[model samples]
Every structure is written in structure tokens, then in C-alpha cells.
Target: MRPLAILGDNITTDHLSPSNAILASSAAGEYLTKMGVPEEDFNSYATHRGDHLTAQRATFANPKLFNEMVKENGQIKQGSLARIEPEGKVTRMWEAIETYMNRKQPLIVIAGADYGQGSSRDWAAKGVRLAGVEAIVAEGFERIHRTNLVGMGVLPLEFKPGVNRHSLALDGTELFDVVGEIKPGADLALVVTRQNGEKLDVAVTCRLDTADEVHVYQAGGVLQRFAQDFLAQ
Candidate 1:
């Protein structure tokens, strides 16, 4: 899977799904305008989240986002921005997600310690899963958010001690594959293939943490697991 976004420590739910005013220039705001909604009526994302069209655009919509993949003069560029791989085009986070979605590409996010550390919001997990993020490999995770990710069928893998995105020198120009079986706290291999064809196998700890969580994740999330059981009954 490709790295959709490489983020740093303390990436809160607010960063994943912003609750602030939607500016007219944002992807969600632009979408609302196309739908003929008056700029004055363009509400906060939290208010219009029931509409997937608007909500999906809010993924990584925080203006304060600092995406490592997006850089300007060797400094990490801030804002809700991302770099489309291979092409290396830097665009708003939603535009990049839209492009990958249209391509039907599976994505992954690489993050630092305390990833998803804030108010527990379902939208934080839902938004990434909807964007085709199959997994997230981070230095560490917030407890509630980690469970939420499992509920959404997104694998949460933790780096082994002293191993992190920075140590690996990941510049978002690489592809990743999860090698080996997954189970609670199992060591899984994260196969990193650089743009120049170099490969490295790094071990990551599966954060499933419980047999029940594994069952739910393997069944493709909470709703799917419920449906499967219901039909079986």
C-alpha cells in the first residue's frame, strides 16, 4: 500500500476530522458551493457529517496539518496538504484522497507516537477507512482510537522500540506491504520498498490486542461482523 499521509505525534481526532468553520476555499466548502449552498450557510463539518460527500472531504482537513510528504525548500510544509506519489504532485489533502479513490488504490498512513490522541470521534476512523486506508503503522496509538480503528477494519501496527518513521527515513516515495499473519500483539513484518528498488523488512507489533478485536477486524469491521452473525442465526 502507498503512504497516503505521513504524520507526526499527537495527531488528534480534530486533525483527522476538523470541527472548525469550513472556509470557502476548502474541499468541503467548494463541494458545498457546487451544490448551490450559500457561502453563509456553509456550516462546520461536524454539523454536515451525515452527508458522506461532505464528510469525506473533511478527512485530514485541518489547516494546521503538517504532512511530511509535502515540503518547501527542505522544510515540511504545513496545512492540509499531501503529495501524490510517483507524480509527486502536492495538493490539498481531499484532492489527493479523491485522486487515489478514483484510481481504486488502497492507502496506508504512517504516523508518530500518540497518534489519534484527543476526543474519541468515530469520524476519525471512519474518514480514513472510507478513503481506502487499509492500515496504519505508527510509533504508538491512543487506546480508544486504536480500538476504533479495529472497529473500522483498519489494522493498527505499532513500531518496535526505537523504530519510527524518522528512523526509517521514509519520504513518502515508498511502497509498503504487511508480511506475515496477524494476531493480537503479533510481530508482523513491514516490507518497505523504496522508489529506487531498495527493500527493508521492519518488524511491527500488531495492536489487535484481543481475540475479539481480531475477529471483528477479520470480519471487516463491526457492522459486517454483526451482519455475518445475524445471517448465520
Candidate 2:
């Protein structure tokens, strides 16, 4: 998987998918405008989440988003920004996500502590999964959000004790491979291959805590598993 974005600590589901008032310049707001919905009628992202077309655009759309992939004046800049790989082009987060979607690229998000801490918003996980993010490696994760990710078929891996994004010195420019089988609390290896032909393996723990969780992930998510079960009967 390719590094799609690098985030700092205490990133809430609100940050992943904001529920605040939609601004005219935001992706969701613009789409509403094109569809003839008046600017004032464009509700908060939380209200429109059932509509994937609009919700997907709001993933990581928080106004306070601080993607380390974006830098300014030789320092990491804050905001909804992303640096696309191979070309190393820095662009707006939504634009980069659109580019990756066009290329069918699978993405991995690297993050610091409390990776998903906030209100238990299912759309938070759904939005990223729709954005082509296949996995997330972080120092820690909220119990609810971790389950939410598994329910959405996104693998959640935790860094070994005391290890974090900073310890790895990741610049969000590496190709990552999650090697090994899926098992609750299993020791998985995250192999990072640098752009200059260097490699390192960091141990990560699979965050699936039970057999049911594993089954849900294997079936592609909670909804998919339920659908299959319903069909089987």
C-alpha cells in the first residue's frame, strides 16, 4: 500500500469527517451547488452521510486538518492537504484523493497516538474506505473507531509499544506492505520500503480483538456480512 497521508495525535472522527456547517468552498458544498441545492440548504456533512457521493468528498475534510504530507517554508504545513506519491506533488486533500481514485491506488494512512478518537461516527470509517484507504497504522486507536474500521473492512494495526510515526521518521513517501496472516492480536509485520531502495520491518499488532471481528473483516464489513447471512438463509 502507498502512503496516502500522515496525521498527528488525537485525530477524531470529527477530523476524519466533520459534521459542522458546510462551507461554500468545501467539496460537499460545491457538489450541492452543481445539483442545484442552494448554498444555505447544504447541510452539515453528518446529515448527508447516507449519500456517499457527498460524504466521500468530506473525508478528512476537517478545516483544521493537518496532514504532515503538506509542508510550507521547509516546515510541515497544516490544513487539508496531501502530497501525491511518485510525482511528489502537493495538492488539496480532496484533489489528491480524486487522483488516487482515478489511478485505483490502494492507500495506507500513518498516524500518531489516539488515531481515531471522537464520537462514534460510522461515516468516519466509511469515508476513508471509500477514499481508497485500505489500512491504517497508528500508535493507538479508540475502541469504538477501531471496531468501526474493522466493520468497514479497513485493517487497523497498532505500533509496538512506544513506537510511533516519529520513531519511524516517515515522510509519507514509502511503500508499505502488511505481511502475515490475520489473527486477533497477532504480531503483524509492516515492511516499509523507502524510495532510495532501503527497507525496514516494524512490528505491528492486529487490532481485531475477537473471532467475530475477524469474520466481519473477512466478509468485507458488517453490512456485507449481514447481507451474506441474510442471503444464505
Candidate 3:
């Protein structure tokens, strides 16, 4: 898997799925306009989130997002922006997701401490899973959001203490592979292959935390697990 977006500490659910007004030029706004919704009728993202089409566009849609891969003159460019690897094309976050979806690419997010902070938003986890994010490796995670991610079937891996994206010098330019049997609190290897053909294996702790969470994840999420249990009864 490749890094879809490299982020820092304190990334909140609001940043993952902004509740603020959607601008006319944003991916969600343009989609609404195409569906013939009047510009004035384009409601806040929180209101339209029942529709996955609109809500998915809100993934990483926060205007204050500072995606580390999106840089200008050595400074991180702030906005809902992302860089498409190999091609290195910078585009709106939703558009990048569209491109990856079109390519059928599996993605991963590399982040720092306190990932998924703030009010618990289900869509924050749902959106990334729908975007084909298979795993997230972070320095740490907020308790509730970590559970949310597991419920959504997105693997949450925590970095060993004192080790992080910065220490590894991950610039969202490398390919990553998670190697090891996954279980609650299991230590796994994150194999990072660099552009120069160099490889590094870093240790990460799987954050499933409970046997039930492992079962839910293995079933492809909470809802799927529930359906399976009901059918087997």
C-alpha cells in the first residue's frame, strides 16, 4: 500500500470530515451543483452526510488541512489537497480519491500522535474505508476513534514509542507493506520500500485491543459480523 496522505498529530474527526460550509469550488459543492442543487441550498457537510456520495467528498475536506505531501517551496501547503504518487500530481483531496478509486489502488495513511481526535464521527472512518484505505499507521490514536476504525474494518497500527513518521523520514513517497499475523495487541512489521529501492522494517502494534474487535475486523466490520452471526443462528 502507498501513503494516500501523510499527516501530523491531533488530526480530528472534524479535519477528517469537516462540518463547516462547503464552498462552491469544493468537490462536494460541485457534485451538488451537478445534481442541480442551488448554490444557496448547498448545506453544511454535517447535514448532507446521510448521502455517501456527498459525505465521501468531505473526507479530509477541511480547508485547514495541511497534508504534508502538498508542499510549495518547502512549506507544507494547507487545504484539502493531496499528492498522487509516481505522477506526483497535486489535486483536491476528493479528486485524488477518485483517481485512486479509478486505478483500483489500495491506500494507507501515515500519521503522527493523537490521530482521530475530537467528536466521534462515524463517517470519518467510513469515508477512508470507502476510499480504499486498508490500514492506518500512527504514533497514537484517540480511544474512541480507534474503536470506530476497527468497527469500520480499517486496521489501526500504532508506532512504537519514540518512533514516528518524522524519525523514519516518510514523505508519502514510499510503498508500505504490513507483515505479520494480526491479533489483539500483536506486534507487526511495517515494511517501507523507498523510491531508491531501499527497504526498512519498522515495528508497529496492532490496536485491535480485544478478541471481539479482531473477530469484527476479520468479518469485515461490525455490521458484517452482526449479519453473519444472525445468519448462523
The whole-model lDDT of each prediction reads 0.94, 0.91, 0.94
Off by over 4 Å in 3: none
Q: lDDT tens string, model 1, 1-233? A: 99999999999999999888989999999999999999999979899878989988899999999999999999999899999988999998988998999999889999999999999988999999999999999999999999999999999999998999999999999999999888899999999999999999999999999999999999999999999999999
Per-residue C-alpha lDDT of model 2 across residues 66-117, encoded as one tens digit per residue: 8988888978887778999989999878899999999999999999899889
Over the full model, what C-alpha lDDT does candidate 2 score relative to the true structure?
0.91
The residue-by-residue lDDT of candidate 3 on 1-233, one tens digit each, is 98889999999999999899988999999999999999999979999878999999999999999999999999999999999988999999998999999999899999989999999999999999999999999999999999999999999999999999889998988999999998999999999999999999999999999999999999999999999999999
Of 2 and 3, the candidate ahead on lDDT is 3
Cα TM-score of candidate 2: 0.96
Candidate 3: residue 107 lDDT (0-100): 98
Question: Which is better, 2 or 3, measured by TM-score?
Answer: 3
- Model 1 residue runs over 4 Å out of place are none
Global Cα lDDT for candidate 3: 0.94
**TM-score versus the correct structure, for each prediction:** 0.98, 0.96, 0.98
